[model samples]
Target chain A: MKITFPHLGNVYFAAKALFDELGIEYVVPPLSNKEALEIGTLYSPEEICLPFKIMIGNYIKSIENGADTIIITGSCGPCRFGEYCELQMNILKKLNKNVDFIVMDVPSDIGIKEIFNRVGKISSNSSKSKKEKIKALVKALKIINMIDEIEADAHYIAGYEKNSGDSKRLLNKCKRDAINSKSADEMINILSEYKRKINFIEIDKERKPLKIAIIGEIYTIIEPFSNLYIEDKLMDYGVSSKRTLSPSWWVKNTALSPLKINSLDIKKASKRYLSLCIGGHARECVGEAVIAKNEGFDGAIQIFPMGCMPEIVSKAILPTVSKDLNIPIMSLIVDEMTGEAGYITRIEAFIDLLERRRKSVLFRS
Target chain B: MYYLGVDVGSVSTDIVLLDKSLNVVEELYLKTKGRPIQVIQESFKILKSKYDDKQITASGVTGSGRNIASFLIGADAVKNEITAHAVAALNIDKEVSTIIEIGGQDSKIIILRDGIVIDFAMNTVCAAGTGSFLDRQAERLEIPIEEFGDYALRAKSTVRIAGRCAVFAESDMIHKQQLGYKQEDIIKGLCEALVRNYLNNVAKGKEIIQKVFFQGGVAANKGMKAAFENALGFEVCVPAHYNMMGAIGAAILASEAVKKDEGTKFRGFNIAQSNIIASSFECDGCPNRCEVIKLEENGIIIGCFGDRCGKHSGKIAV
Candidate 1:
């Protein structure tokens, strides 16, 4: 059976590598874009969040491409995202699309046996032995971690690269080459080579570029298309940017969160502002902003889709954080109607303010 | 030398000229009326007739139509309305702690501490407490927009008007009028309602400190200013050039941005005669289908933007 899943930043690379290793036929739906949003909005409920609509569009596109089995991860948070899977399934059923869903909830929530059963549906298709199957999973995990590392390196080093756009060019070329690789091993090898190459790129040591932390909704922060490729824009401005949320980070955080041992520092940092998981990544967003200030970041930009309930709460709380930390924070609320020019103008103004603040005599260190 | 600043809003286009020390030397306010380009050119023509183009060292654009205006005038610095307002307010009063800027289409509250922006909030996806709403209500009441504030000031007592939305406010006003309320009372009630909406939404959770400054097109309404003061229990100072503050701030920023050696990018007054064509086309290269906007100067493409992927924007220099 041809399987498919919605895009989530670099998670597609890991999924592709795993499917390729397992010899499972799968369709990776095209990247989320205006067409997907239009289709999704047309079919979705008026008040539902942006990510839900985008995912629905991805499903329909994959279904049209002959994907009969859909794999989706599940969550039980207070955020509306947890409810998306059920609603999406109903929508597909109503549309008369013939597809089977394999939802992989946390083992604790769905039970270990059920988790294995869902995973086994796909692994069962592979003729490889148990050892090879385990190795393939390991390889996929390694690839995701490496890719995230490479991305973080490239984003940070873009500011200090001796040659302008060197890091950006390398990052783009690496992704393109990896995606074109025929085999999983080749893809992994390509990523590792690029990962090593990123470390060797010549970087200027004397440059004092602005360092900013990106904090907000996980989906909007990770997905370049959602945030209008803000990180790339920051790179172009010769500004160092760092985001704590990544596909690999999500995996690790989810795994260790049930044990009450995940992201202790973020939890501690956010305790003063938001102690509880107010559903979604509001706590993380707040925690990251505070941590960013302490880490010597010049400023932070918080981006979330318009009308995101959890992020709205975070937006209200961010002003207090900005005041207490004495760090400039700008919250950009984006929707389908968001004008690109206005959005860029705000970013440029924020950068201009940061530069002036840095050079001002009053705030000298 | 002079620095020019242009503030292009939905309802008005304001242009200001500032000397090297940033003193406002000349200013013009005109109705935008859905035509930013023509209004800007008209303002430039008036300025060119009075001042020498060679003396204008640099130019900046701000407000909603900043991008289009910047492209049209070749502004050295392009800024958002928020920053421009805050800068202009601080310039007026170094100790200004709060700025309530209610413009044609949007409203914003800037909270400052020690001459720096500490926190701020703007009205979200609503136009209930802005100048356009007042203009519409004035037209419906057959009152000239300029005299609407005077009518509110003449009221002895106010009648309740829902200010949460323009629709509800209009219906409430009509309902009050039917209940035998005077037009003056209804106008006053509307002003109070708009202020209530602004305080609850835009200025919610913000500390209303002393030395508050109110600047924007809506600041011209003494009734609204009185409503703000009455609500906050503090005096709100409306700058002399309240409506032109954005333009003044843009000029200040431009003066700071351009160095003597670097020179200015101002396209010159002759650009007013050039045929600037703006058009958009959807790029089918990807699923994004980004509707890229292109601006041509006398048939040659000068600027292209709006592509999420820099496919088209990268090719165009500006």
Candidate 2:
């Protein structure tokens, strides 16, 4: 059985590592691009959010490349994402692209035994011994954390690097080397080496760069293509950006959620504005904005897909946060029809506003 | 010597020549007619008729077509319309707190505190409250666009029109016309509806204080200015050169940019007679199918852009 999965940033790296170690045949669909979005848009419901359409495109592309098993995480939350699996399955069936779907829900939602049963369905196809399979899972976990750390450091240091583009160049090379590694251990080594190198890059401590926190929907924030590679754009502009969400963070949050100690800092930060979980990381988005302000970030940018219900709530509340915290915040909504020129203009104007606030005597009382 | 500024927008191409002291020396506003290149060259031809190219110190470009316009004219400074507009407004009056800009295809609200731009918002995913919609409504009513404001001013009573969407607004206008409303009153209603839409949508949640400046092509509509004043319950200041403020700002910026330079990057007025072409092709290198735009000058490929990969974005050596 050839397995496939949608792209969610570096999650594909972990999936590749696990599948390779398990001796499972898998087809990694091409990176999310225009063709995938076009196909997905043609088949998806008109009102569905951007991530769903992109996922549909990924599935179709994989199906064309001989993938029969599709695995995706499921949520039982109040968000429309909870119904995505059923809708996608029906759509694929209608298109006559037959494939098996393995939904990995949280242990509390699906029960531990049921979760393992679902997991065993995939592991059963592997020829590896039980111990080696466990080892592979552990390595995949390590790979995700390492990659996330490398990416975070690269983004932050880009603003301080004495030589412009050093961090970005190294970061790109690191991702390329990690992907091209023959084994998971080799990938880990390459990642560690690059992490060390990025830290040692020459930085002028006296130089102050605009620090922006990226807070928004998980799918849009984690997936670069969905948000039109905003983080990369920020890096190119020599702005330090931080995002609290990542695949590793999700893994840890899911594991600790049952213990009721997951993301306690974020919950406490978000308590004043949003006291309840409105679902789909709305609370997390609010919390991150507050956290960014408290951490002395210059501004925050909230990016989400058009028609995103949860983010719409966050967008409404963010103006208040911006007023109270005295931190500038900009909300960018991305859809398939999002024009690049308008998007760039908004970003440029926001940056100009921030810079003028710092340097211009016009703001002096 | 003069610093030149060009604003190539969707509907009009505006050029302004500023003296060394930043006074407006000459101004020209020409219809774009969907051909910015031709309009820009025509402006240069007009400039050449009056003064030598050597008399120009520097040049800057702004508006929606700033990139291509800058490339063609060899501008010393290129900036987005928001910064240019804010700069021009601040230059006119430092105490200006709010800028309501309604251009041909888009509208924006810029808020300033203590002469510094603090917050701003632009119309997103909709063109319901811009000059283009107003022009279309005037055309549908068989009224000259320049006389649209005069018609609104002559209205005996106000009529309510939907301002949520352009399509709905048109249908509502027709519905009102069918219900026997006077043409002038309907035009007045449209002006008010558009102002309401702009305030609610583009300027939503913005803290607009005193010394508000209204600019852009729509600012030419006296009815719009009056509607803004009536709605906000205060006078909305429209600058004398409101329509060409973007070009004025661009010229001011160019003068500042060339302060340390040996000379201006102005390609000279002779470029008006040069052959320049912009063409695009769907790149087949990847599935992205990016429409790569290539610019040529005198049969030589000058530059290529819009490709995600760097493969085709480089300048081809002559």
Candidate 3:
């Protein structure tokens, strides 16, 4: 049976997780590029959002190579993702390609458990009892979650200096090792050992001074699109940074939060065990900023979309907290118009602030 | 004397330290535990334990999170992963015509003109065919992620799986399994789906050139490698440090930045002592609800971020 992932970002994480559980093999779409865009734009109707084009393109890419079934998540939110299954299905049918589809909506539409039970229909009947199926799924979820966690750690590492390959080599090795891991316990061991092996060179204490924290919505935070690549912008200024949250962290934190809710955002940010704050991870994120300040970071950054509502609310509340906390904060509202050069100029000045502040503190101390 | 590069992506942060001669010195792969600060702090602690006395000359930061890192650590130079990755690839194998990258959150295809990124496209929206997707598949099968390729290799006939997206892929896998397809066949089909997704999404517009180099975490999958070869009708080369190329790229850029800059703002190898603060303010300055952030240390504003306008002004910490 073939397995696949749909959509972007955490979907990758989700796919990894699902596969690792079932002990199955799956393929990855080619790196999305101009060709995929062309195929998607050509095949998918223009009226659909850009994501659809990309999604349809993924299916054809997989189908051409001999995939007969596709798997997708189910959503119920107002966002277009909720209807993605229907849209994608119609688009595929338009192409007249006979393929089976499994849309597993995460948020739940009709019933969560019932939808999940559909798994019984796929594998051996008696061989797969409810307990066994759940066990497999749980295992898969764990692996996927672990991979996501690793990816997140790597993002922060990306902010550092070293040959690009150094971190990637280590990360890939870690991922390969984790994937081939003997068991969950073994995976944790592999990750811990891997982490122990990393090396982060510190600048001359006399010279090395400024530290910043970057927080924001997932898209702008990770994707180069909405934010116009804020990471490089700050790096140009010579400031080190701290970021909050990654898929890996998100998953692990959720799994572990029941025991320590007060420490993690899953508890600090909302009533739910998970981060249901929408974009408002900002509230807890700002709290993290306070924590960072207490830890001695120089400043903080909030990255998000121009019109993102959850983050906007966070923006509204962040300043008052900033004033009370006495921490400097920078908020970047990005869109297509936010160019590279503009971002660089602002970042330069921000670094200047950090440098000057560091000098003053040095003099005072 | 050496330079270092770190590509901090959403899924993971990669650290690659290279000598002035461009020899590999040290490498690290870390999971960002909701705290990039902790990741760096941990890295520094580990690094100090190993090579605190080494004469490190320069460093670079790249990837989506580069700006945050550059400021936090005083990165010498900041470069884009595409440029850094392409540059490093060319340095390793100049003849490479195409570069494929599949990280945790996104996928990219870079076409080169004499080693420069003349054309590129990325799939930031879909997760159908990324390393993470494969990991999920591996999880479902209860197989080690590394052995996904082995499973694919054993498949006599692959039951096609649609990897259009994660949601579809998962459900489809379940369906195929219900159809009573062998696990190996399902896996092989899944491998083909990844190849299909990659080609259709990111590689569609561009010509499949020879001398293609596949990097990023996904390159670890042998099934994917074979699928790529089968689909493209050519061999795809996986870089030795395929996953860390972005970090290496940033390091290359950092090496240049250190040479170009005079002073360093590194917070020392013991950045553990440095304080970091993040806050937000919605800019009533306009209808745009811009939340500007200010960074400071010892009661002094050090840097600013999260503003769309230049309204929030200060010396940037990096």
Candidate 4:
């Protein structure tokens, strides 16, 4: 079986490592771009969210590349994401593209045995021994964690880099080197070397840069193409930005959720605002905003797709959060029709607000 | 010597010339009519007839078409309308605390505290609460846009109209017209409805403190001014150069940038006669198919942009 999956930021890198080490055939669809969006928009229902449309594009592109199996994670939450698989399957079937789907749901929802059965569907295609397959999984996990750490460090150091664009240049190079590695071990080595290089980059501690936290829908915030590469723009503007939601964070949260030990800080921070899991990481978005203020961030930006129910609730609560915490938060809604000019204007104005606020506060002191 | 500012907006292109004392010496507001380059070139020709290009020290461009306008004129400073508007307002009145700027295709609320902008919000993906919608409605009613505001002032009692969407607002107006409401009352209701929509959407959750300066092309509408007063329960100050504030701000910013940079990048007013051609083509390098814009002057490529990968865009120097 040639496995295929939708793009979600850096998850594909780990997926590549896992499938490579497993000796299993897989097709990695080209990076999300205009073509994928056009194909997705052509087939998706008019009112569905942005992520669903992009995922459909990924599936079709993979199908074109001779892939016969699709592996996707399933969720049974209050959010519309839970119903994505069923609707997508029907859409693909109507298009006459017959492909097998292996959904890996959480153990709590589908039971551990069912989870393994789904996993075995893909592993059965690989001739590797059970121990070797487990090693591959472990290596993939390490790769994700390392890459996330390296990315986080680069973002934070961007504001303080003595030489402008140093961190960004290094980070881009690291990704290029990591993705080009022939094996998982080579990728890990490249990641670690870049991580050290990023840490050692000359930084100007005296330079006070505007710091922002990115919080919102998982798909919009994690996927760069979906949000028009806001993080890249921030880096270019010499702003330090952080986001608590990432593939590694999602993996850790899922694994430790049943034990009631996952994201304790976020849970506590968000308790006063959103205590319940309304699904689709709305609670995490709220929590991250509160934490951003406590962590001395200058401001926060929340991004979500248009008509996102959970984020709409979070959007309503964010102004209160901004007022209560005395932190500035700007929410940007994106869809297929989002204009770049308007988006850039908002971001620039937000940054100007933050910069002027710092000056006025410093003047008072 | 004078400083020049140009605001190339979606609906109109505004140009301003400020003397050494920072007072506006001349200003021109011309409809863009879907041709920004021609409008800019025409404005430059007019300015050239009056003053020598060497008399201008620096130039700046703003609004949605700032990038292209800046490149076309060799602007020293290229700034967004928000910053340009804020700078212009703050320059005009230090005590101004709120700015309600409604322009063509975009409306924004900028909240300032202590002469510094603290917060701002712009209308999202919708032109319902903008000058363009009002212009369209005025056109549909066969009333001169400048006189539409006066018609609103002539109304005896306001009628209720939905202003959430432009299409709905137009249909509601038609429905109200069919029901025998006076033309002035329907217009007055539209003015009020647009004010309500602007407050609830663009300026949502914003604290509108007094010394509120109303600016932009829509500021010319007396009915909008009255509606804003009725909604906010305070006097709204409209600057003398309300329609050209973005351009004025651009000029002020360009002057400031010139002081630091010690030289202007302006190509001179003679550029109006230059053989400049702007065109675009679909890049076939990848699946992105980015429509790369290429600018040529007398058959020599001057600049290229709009490519995501920078493969085509990097070929030309700014």
Report the C-alpha lDDT of model 1 over A74-135, residue by residue, as the tens digit: 88888888888899889899999989999888987888998888888989998888998888
TM-score of chain B of each: 0.97, 0.97, 0.91, 0.97
Worst lDDT run of 10 residues, candidate 1 chain A, spans A356-365
Clashes of 2: 0
Over 4 Å off in model 4, which ranges? A360-365, B282-289, B309-318
Ranking by lDDT: 4, 2, 1, 3
- Among the numbered candidates, top DockQ falls to 4
Candidate 2 off by > 4 Å: A360-365, B282-289, B314-318
TM-score of 4: 0.95
Ordered by DockQ, highest first, the candidates read: 4, 2, 1, 3
Task: Specify the CAPRI tier of model 3.
Answer: incorrect
**DockQ for all models:** 0.33, 0.40, 0.01, 0.41
Tens-digit lDDT track of model 3 for B1-318: 667677777667888788877867799988764566567767777777766534566767777677667766668776656666777898898788899888776677877645454445555335578777777778877899879888888889879898887789889989989989999898888889878888886675466698999998888888888888888898899988888898887777666565556754455565655666655676665323445766655456666766543457533221
Index of the highest-lDDT prediction? 4
Candidate 2, residues B107-126, lDDT tens digits: the string is 99999888888999888777
Better of 3 and 4 by DockQ: 4
Cα-based lDDT for every prediction: 0.86, 0.88, 0.63, 0.89
Q: Please provide, for model 4 over B1-318, each residue's C-alpha lDDT reduced to its tens digit, 9 standing for 90 to 100.
A: 999999999999999999887799999999999888889989999999999978999999998888778778898888788888998999889999999999998999999989988888888757897999999999999999999999999999999999999999999999999999999999999999999999999898889998999999999999999999999998999999999999999998898888878788898888788888899998987555677888887898778877655577662111
lDDT of 4 by residue, A1-365 (tens): 89999999899889999999999989988878777888999999989999999999999999999998988888999999998889889899999999988887899999999988988888898899999999999999999999999988888988898887788788878887898898898899999899889878999999888999999999999988899888877886788999889999999999999999999999999999999999888899999999999999999999999889999899889989999999999999989963477787788878878887877322100
